[model samples]
Target: MLLPVVALLAASCKKMFDVKPEQVVDQTQMYRNVNDADAAILGLYGKLMNLAKQHVVLNELRADLMDVTDNANDALKQVTLNNVASNNTYADPRAYYQVILNCNDVIKNFQIMVANKKFTRDEFNQRYGDVVALRSWVYLQAGIQYGTVPYVTSALETIDDVKDESKFPRLSLDKLIDTLIKVTDSIPYKDVYVTGSSLVTTIDGYNTGKFFINKKCLLGDLYLWRSAFTKSDIDARLAAGYYKQVMETGGNGDYDTYRIKWSEVTTNNDIAVGYWNDGRVNQYSENMLVDDNDYGWRSIFARGQDALYNTEWIWMLYFNASFSPENPFIDLFSNRGGSYLVKPSQAAIDGWDAQVQSDNNFPYDARKRLTYKTLDGQPVIMKYLYNYVDETTYLPTSLLNKPGKWFLYRAAQLHLHYAEAANRDGRHKIAYALVNNGLSYNFDNSPGAGTKRDVTNTQQTFDPETAYQFDARYGDNPTFRAPWHRNVGIRGRAHLKALPVNGADSTTLIENMIVDESGLELAYEGSRWADLLRIAIRRNEPAFVADKVYNKLVKDGNGSAAATRARLLAKDWFLPFKWE
Candidate 1:
């Protein structure tokens, strides 16, 4: 008897928040034609849209600016609360499993198609390879976020379809790493041709782009996952081996390749696999950007014309308006007369200044520009804000359109991975070099340009030779200098310094540096919480604590003060797990 495909694939909803699949395709029909199989694959991509949306919430809430402790006393005040449970609720494991089911369907149907002589060997292999890679990608997200997830290689249709959910406990870190490695090995390294109407086609012709998995990016992701899961198990040999693979595959031996891959505006050789959201046509952008005046929560309040942008955001799901009208980041950063939805925190600004300055010994080195702003004929560096805007007019078609793709995996992060691995494996020199090299990419030694006051120009002038002198004069006191003048002057002091050649626990120091760099480099890439968890686990940090005191501050009659105070309570910060 033929098993019903719906029985095999329909997911059992456990929570009210679970999104019911709007449409379901029968497995029998799924493999009968190329379009059927292609549609199944498209479903996998559709599931990825959830990842893009989740990323925005995760990045904004976890960044230094948002207070994780706050919960609105009433529905009105809760709008901006950074409650972990609320965020975690949005990242439901079942939602991820739904995506996995789509991938499983693709893999299963592709196998069936090949067996039935419906697909050639080349077609089967290529399609099978894509499915395997996509499945691995989904598992990586699940494994990293919710450790020891149920590994389902087949689609689940009915309640009985879920084979031994209780029996499938969390896999060990070593096992998880092995699984990812094997998955990566299965994908073909060579390029594959894709011909189809562009999802964002402005005209009628199909817009085709060559697609293939870069061994380096895949391996880099593997290493990152490995590092995340098995920090203690990481040794020098393994670290060097993986890093060498990344460097060799990267072609550009320089570390810049890893860093630049994070740019949404540029898509070249570095990316392994990721989605692009052009505002003009992407559905996700439409949901986020289009004025929802007729229905839902957005319809009640002033419809947010701009989405969300945080200078702290390192890697984002980008939306290109030329491709789609719903690009969210465009509205978020473009100052089209909208209320600035996101603002850099004072702490983040201070951190940016610190990152740009030179160390006392290394006077010539430049620092990373974490954020940027224009003020008083000088550019004030804001650590989180990367894009520049000229006007703040609220119009759908404003010139403030800044379109850049979101980076899933960046080169700078890989360097940090190398540094961490080196530190873990007792390669202090290598770790230091990797960290410094990554920081060097953002340094600028050129004199100030644009409407510069004489004093501003003098202070903004970045001379490698005099970097030490500048650090000494302005390093301790950042406030003394004008905001614009201070931007370049502090580069020497702010940039991460190289590790000491000898220390009691050089490895630990390297580890700390890696953690610090992770915080500095990936401040707003939906990584802070993960980083915090990793550090807590590695360092055995006692239950999280809140450093800020809310009572000392005054609040307007609005519940902002109480909300802020409640947010400051460390105990209430973490997500309350249903099981916990």
Candidate 2:
């Protein structure tokens, strides 16, 4: 319906993450009707796609989870080693700002369309609700990754909009939060899902609820970032309140709104058999070992193609090959055949292995196997892989007609976000269940008839292929369940380094555990850098940050340990935007 333009040809970060004058559309014409407004909304998501993979490198690779293999290009290596420069090409200011400009276009024009009676009141709020949340989500990403950035809200309709330095100066952290809070407060569908199974026409084709931001999800994360950056208990409480609203809405007591579809493991007729061989259903095949899907972990990525409406993804970015062109992620991360510039760090592989609780004849944390694969003595990161799944399974990737589905906000992150903020705010009971108990919990401490466990009943068994812990059939109990008491869920399934109900840890240690759980769940998904940076910047704890991220990279010989440490200690933590 509409064609999205590239970054404005003007200076990057020089003028409000400027876009050239040609990039701006006629606000009057674009807001003519609901259909016209829908086209403009599509443009916003197109720009978001441009930022999706860039965010991964900006956040994930800069942290410890990734490293440049010998085959990686110089620019990628520089970012990996923290040897980035001011004019380096990948350090593009337009990456974040481009998304902002698209958002600004929609935010600026919504009221015009609404006043014209082009859309009913509810439809206008529905549209306005999305525009508001999308803008905040962009700013949240900006605040976490880039220290201070030029903030703009009104449409950049002229060269004057592009060149006016006095109009939009880089905002301080506090100012960014103020602007964000004001915007988030205005959305009508805060914790609520607005799309009701109807498809809207956009540049990306017809789509549903998965692509739109859930207002409370954005607000909760925004507050969490503010709390982490400012170290304010007040901010932390605000974040928890929003997250509590999210829990109350769709996924109450169960991550049903955002969980993996593990039922397909056994339910599918062509499902890989013998995934959990425990001598029960001998579905093993020709290979000595079971296939990756048969093992349970690979299914997450395969299933991610349809995860949009699921509980695991609060919101995600979808790409349509026919409507647009190519999904950058598929080109960048896919292994079927592409220029593979990066891979998982050896440290990440080792760290994941070390974190596993028990062998049980396979890997402990399903994420490790699910996240990466070893090739040529190196770990090829496979978190976004779908080609293999398309070839063998009935996953929705085939149905999506596109391969690039980037998860922006997710439930596990929220679980830990709530836990991190709650722990910081001295809400131990709330933080404890978010991780240890999981959404699968039944209200009672006792096992749910079959799969539950305890210290004395540590050897109890649930479905080995099951990703979720609680069962609705047993009556969805919104509390801790069997394996949780015996050190499951956040604990390694087999490794079981339990967060004791009566553990003798101080507040500091419990908070650390909560943050670490975020790592375990959200790893390799473009969040690690901010997770480390937020605490380091707030507490002035470079030493601790170095231990969590830098130490792992250096010890694994990713680059010179001295250079890594020196770069970290000198000046600031995040890369600076080089203004002309």
Candidate 3:
């Protein structure tokens, strides 16, 4: 792509009219000095942190997983019910566009920094890589929520540039992702090692190691999302390619991994007397630290918690409470009467309770307690928070607590993505292993196979014949023969298995399982609504979306469910690009 000469950059006096190409600030001025270079890049991250709350609203709240409280204002309720009006607060685009502007600024200016000898070539690639990743993050949100949005790459600088919002045309999610793949491709990466995998040794340290994304993470993520929108095996295989790269980056097949205590895996055997048979009110011992314990969650991953040095986050935005508006998690999920807008839906609560009740041996899912904080009258989500307290003091839990960090990507998310991609490509054996390998539960198999038989029938194990390493790209591995509902069929605490889904009857079966897993694991962290949209579009299954997202799930008043089902019938997965 060539840029026009200065002579042809604008309209001519006695010629056909043409608009001058808008230039934001002089990229040269922003990136020339080391100080400005640092500030500009840091600013990009700061801008991203600010958009975190809105990101949740657009990504998680719009999905069927939540319901609006009666206390919600009309604007919030409208979005909660998908009664999106042109002027609805949830329909605002600027919240994301502002982040795009910061990304463009960092991108266009970084080159000047390199030219001015402010950063070495290697370092230049690293900083520019961060900017590109941030851009991809925003692009992903907008692509999913808006379907197509003004794809602005360059910053809007001058007065004319600011005024001329129409200069950039809205592009499809496919086109945006194409750009994302290319952006991650350009970053300089190195092979490095961090913990969590002891297998395949070499990994690209594209933007440092595990915390900031390397090329493999970007490629894996980009292609996985891409697979949702395309019917081609090309995208599926491409996703596998990147996911394989991530796996191999670990070397020696995922050694040195972190996992929860085995005793906590399946049902607590002694708890035949637990709440429900069941434990009483959140009584897990303080010493019972799980991988997702808030202690480490805040210590290692919270914003300003020595973030740059901590690993495994892949990409995250750390927030500072000193800003004009502190971290927004409180206002977003506030339990203060009349203040909070969103709460967990009856569907989520009912589904979770049902999942636990169906298996009487199990007391509860640890994730359930961690995710939703059920108040006396109304329940609300708590995944984004535990208590807003200064980490060291834990005492003064402030209602306006501000230390919130967005966990955008992590090893667990990748693992789930790998399993789904493999399953979709018809590689059930490997999919089963990938899911089971790091499965968080340990089975209490002492109950005898009769009581332990998840299906309780002697129909034979789904894949009783063979064993092989998990590799989904090629189907040469051993087979997984678990029944459709799995129903704790696998020989473990959390009986997650490679579902019997290699044939035509199981396509929806497999898809539904993956969607269910994603919702359970990544609840309220963003990506839920995108999952709904992707599945609806990919399978051309509007009824599924309507049934799950609108009707079967929520308790509707105001005919919101019926109205939303009608829109899904129209194949509408997004609010109109323009409010109109």
Candidate 4:
């Protein structure tokens, strides 16, 4: 799979941000400069953007939280029915392989750039590690959907080269996870690239730094998969450690930059709704004032890339309409000016409706209003409908003209995944607290606990591990309050009450809660099917996934629920890898 003519990079550097951006030119002349390398990386991301709709469909449609609408095409309907045809357009692996091919080209050529003294060792390490992580992420997505894929890392001229069975053996999901962990673990630079590096740029007024793949998040995810596949405490602990690295204070001197403070959420119309720090925003619909309180949580998705958003978003990609590949989500999720093909299932709405706030006994999660909304007589996903500017206002059908975002990694995911790992590692109390309430609320509340937020909880007590502890200390004294002291667990940030852990299998119960919380907090964005599949495989219970999908199908009035469940119980968790 050696490089050939390299037609993908013939365009000038200025055209690199186009939808069909180039990856490389002639190998002998390419990677001769850092600018060349930067263009290649940007091009790789452009290719990654093409997979946004496919990624969401592959990850969520097959799972429980999302359902295809009547307007959906045959391929999408096939996905929801768990009867994807071999020729189904959505089942095609070429889009994923297109990304992997670009990542491979970048990784291979960047090494040559470093060797030729065209790039510094540090520069090469950071970019090289990023491309590697991006590739790993793509492979993880591929493995999750297809089960067995040709894990090709070498650069090649055409995607067809991987068809050679002897040279590129198809690896199963478990083996792919192992290879990703080993390869990603070996990278020297595990953190984000140094801030303000040449690789960081501004495109359409948004900083491109968040566009890059996060290395630590990728490693944590890899280890999490491995931990599930092997049921090893060591792997779980390793996964927790990596997630902690992302959640801890960033090096930019911003205290609690990546943390969701316990005080951020509110049941009443006060301060902020969730992670959004922008002052009280007036939410509007159809040029009329609807509600002011609903804007905060929505800001997490609707706001532009800035210090306020960087706190929660670890990695994100934006699609400009002026660019070649417009935001695909506008067509998939928006009911205005676009085809609303897929939507949040009734199961997802019910999941959010079941939540009750701890402090005020709020009937439903505050996030429910922000996630999806009723428009044109039907509920549609709201997260991707508006651009940063008009999230609070319905200013025409902007979905056709405004830019849309694709969330790859964020703070909630870091905490949720860490809690999953910690629970598996025998830290169930900490994990349970992290999901329902913050560490301070569930653990640090005890005798002589200074803050009113802290409470004495003897029933769920556990010795605090230094790695997972978040100090409950409060008050005006900065001397006493540690950085993570402001940290709030995932459900806590949604103002939800803590779930009691009374069962003998506390770990399993808490783990299941974590999985459920993932569905509630992260629905429609992706990761639903993968989360269910991983847990089902780990527990060696096919019904774990089958039951959820079956429930969702039945709730959505799909007659194929029973048949799909039967297929799932037969160990059919992945799409058919027809390329093989």
Question: Weakest 10 consecutive residues, lDDT, candidate 4?
Answer: 284-293
Q: lDDT tens string, model 2, 414-507? A: 6677777777776654466456643333234454445433223222223331211223222223333322232223442212244565654355
Tell me how far the alpha carbon of residue 19 in candidate 1 is from the true structure, in angstroms, after superposition. Answer: 16
- The runs of at least 3 residues in candidate 4 whose Cα sits more than 4 Å from the true structure, single-residue gaps closed, are 1-16, 19-29, 251-255, 264-295, 388-400, 445-466, 475-479, 503-505
Which regions in candidate 3 have their CA more than 4 angstroms from the true location?
A: 1-30, 33-35, 158-166, 190-215, 247-312, 336-338, 356-360, 389-396, 436-505, 556-558
- Using lDDT as the measure, the top candidate is 4
* Ordering by TM-score: 4, 2, 3, 1
* TM-score of candidate 2 on Cα atoms, chains taken together: 0.78
Number of the predicted model whose TM-score against the real structure is largest: 4
C-alpha TM-score for every candidate: 0.57, 0.78, 0.72, 0.89
Expressed as tens digits, the lDDT of each residue in 1-580 for candidate 1 is 1212122222221111112344444445456655454445444543554565345444434334332222212221232343434334544555566566767766776777888988677667666676676667667665645556666776556423443657455564447657877776656632233344221111112121211233444454566555544564443335445554543332333322232222122321112111234545443222222122222211111111122111111222333333222334433333333323343334444444454223223222122222323433333322222322321222344455543344454444555666565566555544554564322222223322322222322333243322111210111122323222221111121233433446454776666666655654555444554555444444444232122213212211224544544664433433332221
Question: lDDT value for candidate 2?
Answer: 0.58
Model 4, position 63, has a per-residue lDDT of 91
Model 3 accuracy (lDDT, Cα): 0.53
2 or 3: which has the higher TM-score? 2
- How many times do residue backbones clash in model 1? 53
Better of 1 and 4 by TM-score: 4
Worst 10-residue lDDT window for candidate 3 reads: 1-10
TM-score of 1: 0.57
lDDT of each: 0.41, 0.58, 0.53, 0.75
* Order of the predicted models by lDDT, top scorer first: 4, 2, 3, 1
